[model samples]
Target chain A: MTGLPEPLRSRLHPLDRTLDTLETPAVLIDADVADANLVRWQQRCDRAGVANRPHIKTHRSVAWALRQLELGAEGITVQTVGEAEIMADAGISDIFLTTNVLGEAKLARLGAVASRCSLSVVADSAEIVDAAAAAARAAGATITVLVECDTGGGRCGLADPAAIAALALRIAGSEGAKFGGLMTYPGAGKRLQTEQALQAAIAACRGTGLTVPAVSSGGSPDMWKDDGLEPLTEYRAGTYIYNDRALLSRGTATLDQCAMTVLATVVSRPTAGRAIIDAGSKALTSDLLGLDGYGLVLEHPDAVIYQLNEEHGLLDVSRCSAPPSVGDRVHVLPNHTCVVTNLFDRLFIVSGGRLQGALPVEARGRSI
Target chain B: MTGLPEPLRSRLHPLDRTLDTLETPAVLIDADVADANLVRWQQRCDRAGVANRPHIKTHRSVAWALRQLELGAEGITVQTVGEAEIMADAGISDIFLTTNVLGEAKLARLGAVASRCSLSVVADSAEIVDAAAAAARAAGATITVLVECDTGGGRCGLADPAAIAALALRIAGSEGAKFGGLMTYPGAGKRLQTEQALQAAIAACRGTGLTVPAVSSGGSPDMWKDDGLEPLTEYRAGTYIYNDRALLSRGTATLDQCAMTVLATVVSRPTAGRAIIDAGSKALTSDLLGLDGYGLVLEHPDAVIYQLNEEHGLLDVSRCSAPPSVGDRVHVLPNHTCVVTNLFDRLFIVSGGRLQGALPVEARGRSI
Candidate 1:
C-alpha cells in the first residue's frame, strides 16, 4: 500500500447549514440564549441591589464564567478545590466554595488554591473549620470561611443560627482564617417559593449578633422573586446561565433561553412507534423519572426517550407528527445541565448554524 | 507570607490497605474476582471450540484486555473508532468493530486505525459499506467487512438473511473491502433465555451459501451456555471481567465473583430512614429501575437508593439491620458495569488489601 489518497470529507451541504446537520448526541450551547439569560439575572440582581456571583459549577468552563463576569457578575462560586484551581488559573480572582472542606489532603489543595486568589469556603462543623484553618496556616494564606446555614437544603450547613455563629467565631479565632459571612442553598423545592422563608433565615442570622456582612442566597428558580435581598449582599445563582428542564418546570426560563442541548441522531427506526438514537446514558445522562424523560426533543417535543442503553437512546416516536428518519439529527435539552456538562470534554459554540469556537469543559471530571 | 510552603505530595493511600478508610461510593475491582471471571469465560469458550474475542468496550483498559488475551482470548472487539484506535495503540493486533462505520470523519479514523492492526467491521446497509470502502481505499488498506444480521437485536443489522447475504456480496465485490462473516447481537432480552434459540440463530448463518469463517455470539448474561457455540467459530463477550447487578440478577455470576464496586460515604443522615451519600449521578451513575436500585449496597443489601441528586445519593436505610452513620463508607455494585467503567478515569487494581497497579480508562468519554 503506497501513495494513499486523502480520505473523504463530510460535505457541508446546504441542508447541513442548519442545526439538524451536526452529529447526533452532540452538546449545543446557544450563545444568544446564554447571553440573554445572563443579562436577565444581572438585571434582577442589579434592581435588587445584590451582587451576582454566578456559580461556575454549572458550566465548569472559564469561558462561560468570563461571559458571566462580562455580564456584570461580581465573582463566581465553585463547589470543589479543583474547580477553584482551574478558575484561578484562568484569572478568576473571587471564588466561593459552597461545600464543606474535609480531610487534610483536600484542605491542603484548597489552601493552595485559596492563597492564589480571593478564595472563601463554607464550614458547617468545628472539625471542618479546624482542618481549614490548619491548612490555611500551613500554606501561609488568609482564607475566608463562611458559616453555611441549613436553609432546608438538608445537604450541608448548620441548622441552628447559634451553631453557625459559633463556627464563624471558631474560624475568626483561628490563625490565618477570617470569617466571611453566611451561605445557604435553599433546597430545590423551596427555590421557587416566596422569599418569606429566606428573609426569616437572614433575620435569624442577624439575631445571633454576628456581623453577616455578606449573605449569599440565590438559586435559578427564585432569583426573579428575590425582593428581600437587603440582607444578602451577594447571590450565587448557577443554573440561570443555562436553564434546564427543571428550571423550565419551575417556570424560571423559557425553552428558547436554554443555552445547552445535546445533538443526537436517529440511528434506528426499529418499530413503527419507536426509533432509537445514538445518544444514551453515556451521552444524555440517566437523570430523570420526575421529569417526562431525560431530556426534551427540541424539534420533536412530542417524541419521548422511554429507555436508554449504554450506547442506544430509545425514543418513542409514536406521538410525533413526523418521525425522524434513519439519519436525522435531533437536539435534546438535558434535565440537569450541570450533570450533562461533566459528561463531555468539549462544547461546540455555534451561532446562526455556524461553528464559532470549541470550548473545553476544563473541569469535566473533577468529582473530588 | 515570606516563604511559600512546598506543594504537598498526594497522600493517596493504596486501595487495598485503605479499603476500610477510603471514602464510600468508591469503585473497587477485586483482582482475584476479575481473574476468576476471565478464566471462567476462557474455559467456557475453549470447551465450546470458539475463539474468544473479548470486547474491550466493557473495561476500556489495555491492561484488562491483555489479561483476557493472556487467559486465551483470540483478540479484542471495539464499538467505536476512537476505542479501536486506543486498543491498536496499546499493541492489540486483531480487532472487530461491531458497529456501523459511517460518515467521512469516522470512516477516515476507522481506516487509519484499521491500517495499524488486523481490523474489520460490521455493516448493515450499502451506505455504510460504501463509506468503509472509500475510507479503506483512501488509507491504502483493506478492511474485512462483516454483514450484520438482525437476529433479533432490533438496534442495527438487516432483518432478512437475503439482505445480509446481498450486503456480504457487495462487500466481496467492493475494492479495499473483503467479506468476512455474519455478525448479530441477539439483544438483551434473549440473553438469559434457553440456549436452543441461540443455537438455531447460529445454524441459520450456515444456510447463507457464503463461507462463514467466523460466527461471533456471546453476552455476559449467557456466557455459561456453550451449546449455542457449536456452529460459531468465535465468541465475542464483554462484561464478564466486571460482573454487575444485571448479570447477578440473571444468575450469571455470584456476588463474590463481581469485581467492580463503588465506594461512597454517607454524607447526610437527615432523617431516621433516609441517608444521603456523596456519590450520585456524577459518581454512581443513574442506570437503574429494571434491576434493583442504581447499585447494590455490598454492606447493607436492605438499603435502597430511592433518590439521586447530581451530587448526593439518597439511600433509604429503613429496612437495614443497622443504618450506616454519617461518614461511614460503603461499597455499591453498579447496575451496569460498562457505564460505570466510563464514569471513572482510573481504576486501582487491589489484591489482598494492597495496591497493585492503576489502570487508565484510555477510551473513556470517546462517544463521538
Candidate 2:
C-alpha cells in the first residue's frame, strides 16, 4: 500500500525541512542508516556463532522485523501474545515470546501462534507450564518453553537456578510443552561501563546448566562487548536497530549512529527563556531516564526541555547562545525509544533530506 | 463487533469472584461510575449556561466521545487534525482543534475536517491564520479561528490583546476563515490554591473589548472553583472523567472517584523492599508529576515506584505496612490520566468485579 497520503505527496514545504517539518513530536527514522545498523548487528551475531533473534519490542514495526529477517536474523522476539499475533499475521515464521505467558487468555493465544509458526516462550512457574501444555494440547500444537532465570535484572525470572530447572523439568514432562532452554535478561550487566560485569554474568549462566542446552543473554548496549559468549547459543538485541538517548548516554552509540528522533517545531515563544514546542508528553512522552532533562535537542544541544505538558514541550534556552525562534524545527532524541515508538502510528523515514516511505507502528498499542 | 476473537472466548477464565482475579498492569474502568462521572460534568455545564465541549484528548476513544454527546455535551475538543479527522469520521459533528495547526499538510487535513464538521481551531500567529485560510479555501470549507491568548500557561497564545485582535482580524478577513472569540488554557493559574487568582484571569479576558463570546476555561484541579465561570460561555474539561494521581494530590477527587486504575502483578520478588511489577514505562508510562515516583499504588499507597525499565516497574515496598508478595495484584493510579489512556488499545470496564465490556481506544495514536 502507498504509505503517503495524496495531499502529502509533494515534497514537504521547506519550513518542514528535515524530519522536523513533518510536525513537532513526530517519529523520524533515518532509513538508510537504520538499515545499516540492522545489517551490522546481524553480522556481529553471525561472527560470534550466536543466533540473531531481534526483539520487536523496540520499533514494533512488522516491516522492520521483515527487514531484520532479510538481513539474516534467525527469528524475532516479542514480549506479549498480542505482539506475537501481529507478527505472525505479517508472515514471520520463527517467533520467541521473551515474557512469561500468564492466565488462560494468553496461553490460548500462544497456542494459536504456535500452530502458525515455530513458537517458543518463557515460563517461570509450574502453573504457567501446565497452562501452556493444556492450551497447546487443546490447539493440537506443541510449544517450546524456556525457563527464565533471574540473571540480575530483578524483573521477572526464577529466583534460583534450582527453581529454573524445576520449571524446565515441568515443561519437559508436560503433555504438549517442550523444554527449550534458559533465558536471562541481565539488564544491569548490559549497561555496565566496563565488560567485566557482563563476563561475570556469562560465567554465572554457564555454571547453572540444569540440563538446559541453549542459554540466552542479550541487550543492545553490550552488543559489541560480547565476551564469554561461547556458552550461549542465541543473543536477542532490540535497541541495536535504533540507538536512543539512554543507550547513547551509556556510550553505546554516537549521536550520528542514533537512527530515530522526534522532529518537532517551536510553536509558541511565550517567554525569553522558555519556548513551547508542538510535541508535548503525548508526542515525546515523559520517560526521563536519570537524564538531565526530557530529551536531547539535535540542533540546540544546549537547550533543555525543562518541562513537558500533554501537548506542549517547554524548551529552556537560558543557557543557549541564541534562542530558537518560532517555526524553527528541532529534532529531539527521546530518553526511552521503545515507549516513544509506541506513541506514534507511523514513522517517516528520511535520508539526506529526502523523504523515504513511511512505516506503520503495527504493534503500537499491543499492551495486553 | 465483538472485540475479542471467537477462539479466545473459551479461554477467558471468569474471575472467581466479581473483580477478584484481575492481573496487575491491566487497565480497569468502572462502567457505571464512569457513566455517572460523564453525566455529572454535563450537568455542571447545563446549569451554568455554557456550552459543554468535552475534550476527547483525555480518552481518545470514539465510543467514549459518543457517550459524552449522549450525556449532553455540545461538541468535543481535540488537540490535532488527525484526532479531529478520526472523531469526524466517527460521526462527531462538532470539533475544536485545541492546539496551533501549523504546516500545509496539517492545515490541509484541518481544512478537510472543517468541511465535514462544525470545526474550529486556535491560532497564535497571523501566518498560521493565513495557512488555515488557504487550506480551507482549497478544500471548499470554512473554519472558525480562535485567537489563543496566553493567560498564565505560557504554552500557546498571545499575551497582548492587541496582537490577539490583529490575528482575529486576519482570520475574519480571510477567504475561508472566520474570527471566533479568544481561548486560554489557564494551566499555570489553576494551581493558585485560591479562587481569587482564577477570577483575576477571567477579569483580564473581559477587560479586552473583543466581546468575549466563548470564554473557555478548564483544569480539573480548579473545576470545582468555578467562581471565574461568570464570563465563560463554554468550558473544556477532560480529566474530570477519570481522576488521576495528580488530581488526587491537588484534592480535586477522592480515590473512589478515580474511575481508571492500572491493574499490575508483582512479577518478581528480587529483594525484600524491591518487587518488580509487569507494568513498566510501556504499561504505566513514565510521567512523574513532581512526585516521588511514577504512580500511586491504590491498594498500598505507601509502596513507591522508584524505578521503571521498558517492561518492568520497580516498587519500593520498604515503607509499606505490608509488602506485596510475588504474584499479588495491585492497582496503580498513573500520575497523568490522559497518557495512561493512550497506552492501551482496549479498556476493561468493570463494576463490583464483573466484566462489563471492552472499549477500544479508537483514537489512541491519533497524533498528527
Candidate 3:
C-alpha cells in the first residue's frame, strides 16, 4: 500500500480472490477477522470479571491500539519507552511498560511520558529503581514502579519474593516514585509458579506497610487462565489479538482465528516438487519459534516452506497434493506474528474480502 | 535516531565505556572498519580482473551504495524494483536487479526505474519477459533481460540449458528488450556445476545466433573464485561488506574484517550464568544459518545468545570467563548481518570508539 500504483489498487482483494492489485509479499490484516479476534479475547476477559490490557507489541499500530482501548481495555502494555511514548502521543492515558526500564536516556524519556500519562514501569533491581526515581524527579513526574518477579520465566525478574519486596519498598522510598505492585510474564508451563511468586511478593510488601495496588500477569497461551490467578488486577496478552501459527500449535487458537497473514505470490516454480514464494524471511520473519517451517501456507496447507533466504521462501510441495504455480497468491501464517508486524511499514486493512485501507506501523523499529 | 533525546544520544556506546548516551540495542557501524571492508572486497575483484557489483540488500543505504560506486564498483545489484528506484533517485544509473520481476504493478515500477537508469533484470520464463517487454514498450524505455540459469541453486531459474536458450532468444527477439546473457547465484560448493551450466547455456544461445555478452555470477562464499569461472564478466556479493557471523563461521572473513555489529546493554543479570541484553530478535535477528546461537558475543566470544524474545536477548554467559554485569555494553555479531540491517531504522556510525552520527536505513522496509 505504501508504493502501490492506482492501476493495481483495483485488483487488490483481501479475501481469496486473485491478488492482483497490491504487490506480492504484503502484510494483509483481515479487519473482520482481526476485529472478531479482538472482541473474542476481550469478551473472555470481561466474562471473567478481569481487565484486558492488550499489549501493543502485536500490532504496533496506534490506530489498532486505540481501537483496543475503545473496546473496553483498561489500558495498554508496551515493551519499550519508545512504544510508551508512541502510545502517549496517541493520547492513550494509562500505559504499563512490561520490560525493565534502565539507563538515564530511557528513564528520562519514560519520565517525560509519565508527566503526560498514568505511566508505570517494571523493575527487578534497586539500580533501575534509583535511575527511574532520579529521572522522574528531574522531570517533576510521579512514576509507578512494579517489581518484576521471575516466577520461573528465567528471563528478567527477581527470583526471590523477598528481593521483589525489597525492590518495591526501595521504589516507594525513592523520590518521585511509588510502588505499583508486582508483574510477571512467566513461561508457558509456569503459570502456577508465577501466581505464587506474585502473591508471596504482595504479602511481603503489605507486611512492610506498602499496598500492592495492581498485580499484572499475562501470556497469550495462558491468557484465559490469568483470571484464576488470585490478586492479578490486570491481564495483558499480545498475540491473542492476532493469533499466529505458534499460538495455533499451542492450541490457543484455530487456523480460522489467524487474523494477520502474509499474502505472497508464487514467483517461481522451478520443479514439480518445489515452488518459491516472494515472501521470504523479510516478510514472514526468521522467528522459527520451534516450528518446522517458516510459516503455514494457507492455500496449500501441506506445502512446507523449508528454506528462506532474505527475499525468497523456498516451498517444498512434495507433501501437497495440489501445489501452487507461478503468479498464484497464497496466504502465510508466520510462526511468530509479533516480529512480522515489526518488519513491515504498513498493514493493508481488509474487511470481508475488500481492501479497506492501510495503517502505518507507527511504533515499528522502536525497540529501544 | 528517530525519537532519541539529545541527552540519550550521547550515552550510546558499543564498547564498555559506560553506555549512558545512545540507548542500548543500537546498530553500530564502525566507519573505518566498513571502509576497509569495502576496499578489501573491491581490491579482490580488481585483482581478479572481474567487475565487483555489491548487492544493496546488505545495507540498503543509498549513501553506502554510492560509496561502493565511488570506490570503483561497476554497478550495484538490488533485490527489488523498489530498491532500484531508490538507487536511481540517488543518481545511480547502472543497476542490475537480481530477482525475477513479475506482476503488472511491479513491471510498471520497473519500467519507471529503467526509464531513469540503465536497468537489467533476470527472468527464467518468457511470461515475465513478455510482461517486462510490454511495460518497457509502454514506457518507451529499452530494458535488458538476463536469462537466469539454475546452475545448481535449484531455486529460481531455468534448469535445462535449452530452456535457458529459449528464454534468451525470446528476450533478444522482444521489441523493447535486449538479451543480456546469463546470471546465477550458485549454491555452496557448486562453482564447477554453475560454470558448466552457464557454458552450456551460452553455447545453446550462440547456436541460436544470440551473442551472450555478460555472464554475471555471485555468492559471497565464492566471490574470490569468480575469476576461475571463465566468461563471468561481473561478480556480486552482499555480505562481504558487513561479514556476518555466518561468514566468519565459514572462514570467509576474519573478526577484524567484520564491520557491522549490534551494540546492546546488559539490562538484566538475572542469574550468575545468564544475562539478558536489550537486543533481541528485533535487533540481532533469528537467522540461525545452522549456527549454535543467535549471535557471537564480541566482548565474550564464549558467550552464547541461547534465547531471544522480541526485545530481550537471553545470553548464556556460563561459558564466559569473566561474564558481563548489568549495564555493560557489548557488541553482537549477528548470524546474518543483512537481516539485522533490515530490522533497524538507523545505523549509529562510529569512528574509533566514538559516536560519529546516525545514518538512516532509508530502504529498510522496501520489501514490496
TM-score of every candidate:
0.88, 0.87, 0.94
Top-scoring candidate (DockQ): 3
* Residue B265 displacement (Å), model 2: 3.7
> What's the lDDT for residue A109 in model 3?
86
Interface RMSDs of the predictions, in order, are 2.9, 2.7, 1.1
| Candidate 1 local lDDT, B8-54, one digit each (tens) | 01212233335554433446777767877888888877876789999
**Arranged by DockQ, best first:** 3, 2, 1
Question: Which of candidates 2 and 3 is the stronger one according to TM-score?
Answer: 3
Best by lDDT: 3
Tell me the spans in candidate 3 whose CA falls farther than 4 Å from its real position: A1-19, B1-20
Candidate 2, residues B295-316, lDDT tens digits: the string is 9887888988988876678888
Work out how many backbone clashes candidate 2 has: 10
User: Per-residue lDDT for A1-368 in model 3, tens only?
Assistant: 43333322333333432345778788888767777788888888787777889999998988778778878899999998889999899899999988877766777788899899998888887778887888889899998899888888888998777777788889989989998888888888777777777778888888888888888888898776543567678888899878899999988888888888998888888788989888888888888888899999999999999999888999999988888887788999999999999998888876657676666888999998
Estimate, for each residue in A104-208, the C-alpha lDDT of model 1 and write its tens digit: 456678889878898888777676678778888888898898877767766656666566666777877899888888888777656533245445555665666
DockQ of each: 0.31, 0.42, 0.68
| lDDT score of residue B171 within candidate 3 | 95
* Quality class of the docking in candidate 1, CAPRI style: acceptable
- Stretch of 10 with least lDDT, candidate 2 chain B: B1-10
lDDT of 2 by residue, A125-186 (tens): 77567777888898999898887766666666765655565666678789998888877777
